[model samples]
Target: MTLSSMSETGTCTDIINLRYQDGSVGSPSKPQKFNYQDFGQLKQTYLRKGRLFVDSTFPPDYKSLGNLSDLPRSVRSRVEWLRPSDILKAQNVKGEPSFFVESASRFDFAQGKVGNCWFLAAIASLTFQKDLMVQVVPTEQDFEDYAGIFHFRFWRFGKWVDVVIDDYLPTFQRELLSVSAKTRNEFWVPLLEKAYAKVCGSYSDMNAGLPSEAFKDFSGGVHMTYKLKEVHDRNHDEVLWGQLTRATKCKSMICSGTAQKGDTIVNTVADSGIVDAHAYSITAVAEVHDGSSNVRLVRVMNPWGEKEWNGKWSDESSWWNRVSSEDKAKCVKRDDGEFWMELEDFCQHFQILTICCENPNFIDGDVITQWKVMIYDGEWVAGRTAGGSLSNSTFSTNPQFRITVTEIDTEEKEDKNVLLSLMQIPSQRYRNDERLRPIGITVFETPAGRIENSFFRRNSPMKRIQLYGYERDLIEQHSLKPGEYVVVPSIMKAYAPGKFVLSVYTKTETSIEPHHEGEDDDDDEDHLILPTPPKPVVPAEKSSVYDIFKSYADQNGELSAWQLRKLLNETIAKGSSDLFDWSACRTMISVVDADRMGRMTFKEFSTLWSKFEDFKKIFNRSNVSKTGTLTYDELKSAVQAADIELDDNMVWLQYSLLQGDSSISLVDFLTLMLRMDNMAKKFKDKSSDGFITMDWNEFAADFMFI
Candidate 1:
């Protein structure tokens, strides 16, 4: 089949060859299916094209610009607009193709829902290759008038590509096409068919797909430089133009075009006195006159409707970069959409945040003398200057393209002033001491000099996570990437330094039940446990390696009767392992039994002397020595073997032995053990029916240090 558009007829394949540098001659991707409400939302936005109401007090996201004065003058004043050479250098710094645009933008689209920013961006690129916009026309095949048909072709890369479109821009009233039952298919059906028949000629027609998807069908010919090919069909969106400007690699800075359906109009950035500012757009400039005005003057309707400079060529503004401080006067404020400025100044300063949106009041009656005004973002290599300095610290200077700040909390102790540190964890490991690399936020408790758990930024921000106050359910914890963080909760909790657990969620109580053997775990195969391993029976007698040590201790110091019994068990089960190996002590068999006390806790265990064993070797070997008790020197040597760091436990143990160097005598040791046994039994108090006491092994674990 053959198709013709703009005086060119060709096969489907022939049309595919029309690709341009930044324009795609290709068909776009198919649009995703929109539900009724989603589609309605889009339509409603178009209907509500009212003037902007910028609220400067709010954050950037919520603020609307009052006028040029309310714009981010700080940014605009400091960062000089990039020269063509600068743009070219910044071009593809990240290795991506960029159409340098600081040289072209004339007008910007204000905050509107129109997706025309992209169209404007494309227009910017088009100017580089010469009259690209006027080259395309919509015609029909096997028919005339081209009423419902469109044979549109645009130059992309270096070629012209044809696309047949049938779908009318979606309208507000679906009922517009619902002309009763009699004319049901008459209006919309003919409109759609005629639209399609014209574009593709006798072949397939209608560009009914996602922007990216349509491009894919057109392939290399039409999408030579548009690079819509890189964006996935599913993620392609009409709002992509704004995001593109922010994206470093999409470096095409300048853009211009008429507003369309899906564009967003924002307040003026030019007014903000900041480059890359936001503003509103009112109407389009169809034609113009010449004389005193060097550049054309397009009439634009401001959202604030505040009349700044309303005249041809905007004699009030510093247009052509030629307005002297003395010549230019302050702008007057008004409350209507009517505002006039030179074409270049109007376009270069404010960027239309969105693509073109429909001007609900555009006059077809009398060609109103107006400009298809645009609001575009300004260029900035550094943050806007406030006084003589940049706003966000020294200029980034391209050290890195992205910067993220995070706050970390430190544990609180029950005593001094404490501070919190916010550090950016580098992906790779290296010592970072640069003051700029990290900063401190000293946390102060409410109503006083007290402190609390470390917060993201220790300082009190205007809007914070809201904890320890009326809104204290503080469940919105952040999931930080794994790395080192810093915090000093309060003087009491001084500094928080440790590897914290990765938490999934926080609740008042866990409430989940522990798994019990033989229980069917909801029929999920997880209930299947491996066969129970037989319990090992350690020998009751026959002194092992530990007995030898016990004998030495006996000769050295009297072994308490309880210690003797532990010696027997240690000899049989553990051989000569140090009694204080972290793992062994933690296993519930080390301390209490050796101390002859069936109960133990960190405080109680503090009084006892301990011997250490190589913690690492303790696990490598089997039973025996798994829970042997050692004396002062022996303990020190054993701990060294384990590669364990000496902690408070080791010191306390040594202190006990030095305090009493009495050698063990069987009789005296037996008496001490007997008393310990009685004390253990009494403390357990078996009389409390359901309340159970932990066994000897558990007692030992109560004081185990990991």
Candidate 2:
């Protein structure tokens, strides 16, 4: 069946007349233009030569830096890589190089050694839907055409990217190590898995993930996660039944996960023959007519292809006898691990349901009436913009976008759905302890044309902020009226840098323009201007370091990293290298940071700074270079200048540990100097042998961790 016969997707309309009327959507970064060759051109190139497509974006020839041992000890794990020829036999049951013996099925994707059942379940669900598999794993590739090359496309960030891969796959003793199809000869399953693994950087990266993510990536669609309890609270069991049926009709992929007890993962089968903490694909949701009346039945397939719910409506259950033989045949697919269960039983068995809505405008032949999606790449620079939630502050300084929705989709019963997805850029691909920061987007229905600071005014109401309670690549869909809206994507922490892709999908004609903050040249200064007089400086008595910190930081509830440096510059010695040390201050902040939230509360800042204040003075007095930082030799000199002494080996070890330039900031200098002083002072006691117990507060105060 063709794509049009399978489902109806939205179309894109003409660009409306909406230009940047005011400030930027988020940060001040210039809008990035993606200029890769279109799929049409790439396809033509491949067909002309019968040569495989090799994605230039993420080249297949690239090799990964082995399981990153450099990652934080908390997250480190090993990964093994092998080739496909090392695993598969030369022929299958039919005695041919396994490309495909027959059409792919839900049974084709059985879970293997990898713990990516969520991903496998999504692939299985796609097999039942005609065009989804073709869209993801391009049919243009086959074993006969394979000159050791294959390519597949996936929806990533805000666009579909073609990922190329070789037939080589990880294996052990001629068995596929990761995902494998039931038939040893079938190459499409492993080829698809290999292509997907390349898109994620490594096979190891797909070890654990959500099926909703896989569905969204497989189809350039919007994903929504729903809790079973919330669905029940909203209405009756029939409500979810209608939803599942509609999803199946529209070819929207759906998957469910069973809840397990406690934090421990349980893989053993339950009494019902269903495995807890496992993902299962929703193959079909049908309202079959029984001899007495119509009954709602949902067919679910386990990726394991063995365990299944043996409750009512199961393969051998009495409920099948009540239904017509034709209906019974449709419900029971015994050995495939697919079984029918009543809609009510499904709700009881599954804890989470995730659905992916294919892009409404994603049609094959038509362009108009389809959903037009706009994707913007943005970064949250710590000192510049990456601020917390807008409810706590204004997102006027963050990246901002002006989206004008001209018309809503009139074809569907529901109003136009605006989907906004924020995805953080992937990082630390090889490292086990990859760091992640919470990120979210806030959309405000502003006056058609407004400036940046307008939203920051006192008590200005916000339309929608923090739509999803938590961050981590949030997706929020709203049925909104056709109009102009301003959106700002931000990291949840103040001054924490993060990169993200903001995807906007609307079932209408929408124009997304970056809001740039600039004064119109038309506003001329023809009138004579008067010279402004210099403001008089206020002279006041000096206060202690703690008192000075409270003065500058009281304006905002938290003290920023930059603010800390300014405080040190004013309260301590001026023109010292320590005063301008950004990296050192950041490092120092991490050390004193209690929650690792990056931003510091006033009390936390005061406690950390009070101990280093004396050392700042000592470092400042010895600042001959005045660069706001000192080299190892300069730091050593300053330490000796302060009459503190340490063994050469000890001094060298401390300096070597300093990151970046192997230099010391005011914070580091103060920390090192104080530690040496504490050691010397304690050594005066004959019984003291370099052992002293320091609380968290004392540790921050006494150490200059260069």
Candidate 3:
């Protein structure tokens, strides 16, 4: 689809356009659709129908796949296609499989052979608070129902998605292959893990990732990472303790990991029982007595279920002797893979600590300041480009977001907080390096009216942060005044393809929306020709192509995109049979029709035609590779041959128009040449007044048809 058609409305399309046919967006304030079949509703429907829930996504196909007893662990290990009921029929208790045994807890999640201890540690932390786990793995479906289908909801990006899978799971030697529960009866852990794997493409994709990412997905919370060395060096233990205490009070999911020395495995077990470069779930942040003084302590849980921290605050440490009996009962429990360590010791050993703080008033329903979240999915490709950060002289080529903060949080003493997060899709399968793209986001304050073109980069930023490596997802918190702003997310390197979800969390009444699709800024709409003043006659020196275009021109020297479509159909097919067609005509018009006026003046048409001829000359010179066209890599030389300098955004737009193709055709090259001229002229007109600006009406006319 053309850029104009994608963004013509300048806002979210109707339910039909959004494909939200069955339900609303599901915001906290939006009306809850009683008929919507989420995990709970679907289970209740099956229960009322007196039938079991059989997930079609993954079905019981034991007879076709061979008996589970005969299947090898490596057989079809790549595909997660076995029902828990088929294999665990003997292990199951009475009926079907239970998603949870009694209630889900830290003891429920155990790390299997897969090196996804980070994920398991996050899961263990998830079980510390009932409200948090329920929000994650909703306790809606039960094993007694005998339904083979089980579903779990995860806070994906900003919305909750119900991922349904049959009780089938990946296994090695018929045992769970990935993350599993400590007990076979408690299937929520493995089932949830399989569903997540399904969402992430396959079980292998989850082999390695940051636990903070899992925490963010599970809790729908904002996560931030603090370096342990920085905290200790700064002597901010009390400050860190306060932050942890507040997070704990709000029921946040927290995890810490030790740093690696050299290339050693982070999960290496140490002689003292503390694993190096390993992830541990922080169970509690409390103060306990240590002989003469009240020592601050933080409790941690190991997913291995045995490697206890034999430190000063270990389960049998002499420090426990100073603790009062009542305090000991509340803090220490049996050897459930949990131990309390001095906060000082915990900080000294761990290198990084991450906390996924729940949105304000989410758990207790204290609606003093309601928080609403929105998510947008976007991507970048090699030939298809997204912009870099705003700090660069170049405007960002990535997806753009326009957010208007109409109301700021005034009740709290601190300034209003806007939580912006970008989570990159895991790229482990493709890269041996295993490190994901280093990513970050920048927000700038723009005019309140229509969005100016990306080339209009004069707008000053409200806040900007540098890029960070993929050890964690990119996150930023901004406290700002209520106004209009734009957010751009990009990788440190340009033109790298990375799929990501951009999530924005703010107080209710604030709105955030995607401004561009990293291709073109033109809003999508039907071809609507606006009335313009009569154009002067075109110079006679123009090529015969002008005469061909004149056949569809009006008395006012105007011709519509439809007219251009007819001309292209009649002329292009006669020469290069596969070169241009009705579809190409639409793209051609989308390029030159910058104002989206649909029709071009005779002067405008002549200018575009001459530019097209010039592009042919440049393309002919740049085809030294003997290819008929120039690949995106060779585009700079082609532009140099044409004696033009395309701005950052225009260059990105041209490559995006190529749509992942390595090369650009004669017609596509000409389209880019003319679009750049049109945008440059408009931008020049706006900048002539010292600042590039747009009023509501001007913006609507320039970008949106509305």
Estimate every model's Cα lDDT from 0 to 1.
0.25, 0.60, 0.61
Ranking by TM-score: 2, 3, 1
Clash count for candidate 1 is: 130
Local accuracy of candidate 3 as per-residue lDDT tens digits, 1-706: 0001101111211111121233445332222221122555666687788876665433434322222222355564443445666547634435555677777777776677656678888888777656656666767666666555676666654455667666766554556655666666568888787667655545545666678878877766667788987997899887787667656655567788887667856567787778877788887767766567778888888887768888787887877767777666654556777887887888888898887765643222233555666666566533223444454433344566788888665775555557777877543322122457678777777764334445346555665335556644676777767887877777766544466767777766677776633334353221111212223445667647667776666422456556676665566434653355555555555455433434565665666666776777777888788666677656767876665667557666677667435677766666666555555566777785656776653454443311
- Candidate 3 off by > 4 Å: 1-97, 170-180, 264-266, 331-333, 360-370, 377-385, 391-400, 403-416, 424-436, 448-460, 463-472, 491-500, 507-706
**TM-score of model 1 relative to the true fold?**
0.19
lDDT of 3 at 359: 62
TM-score of 2: 0.63
State in Å the error of residue 93, model 3.
8.3
lDDT of each residue in 610-655, candidate 1, tens digit only: 3122232332232233333334444444434444445657535543
For TM-score, candidate 1 versus 2, the one ahead is 2
Worst 10 residues of 3 by lDDT: 1-10
Candidate 2, residues 1-706: lDDT per residue as tens digits? 0011113332323322111122222111111111223445565667678865554433433253123223333432232333344344422234445656588777875776656688888988787666667767767655654455666677665445555555665544455556677777677887787767655655556665679878877875666677887787777666666556556556677788988767876577889988888898887767777677777777788988878788988888887788666666665446777887777788788888887766442222124445656666566644345555664443555667777777765665555457678887543332123465677767666665444554555434344334433444587665556777877777766555556777777654567666544455332222111111111122343235445655555222345666666666776537554444666556556555543445555556665665576566667766778876787777777777767767667777887775346566765666566556655754454234656664553344334331
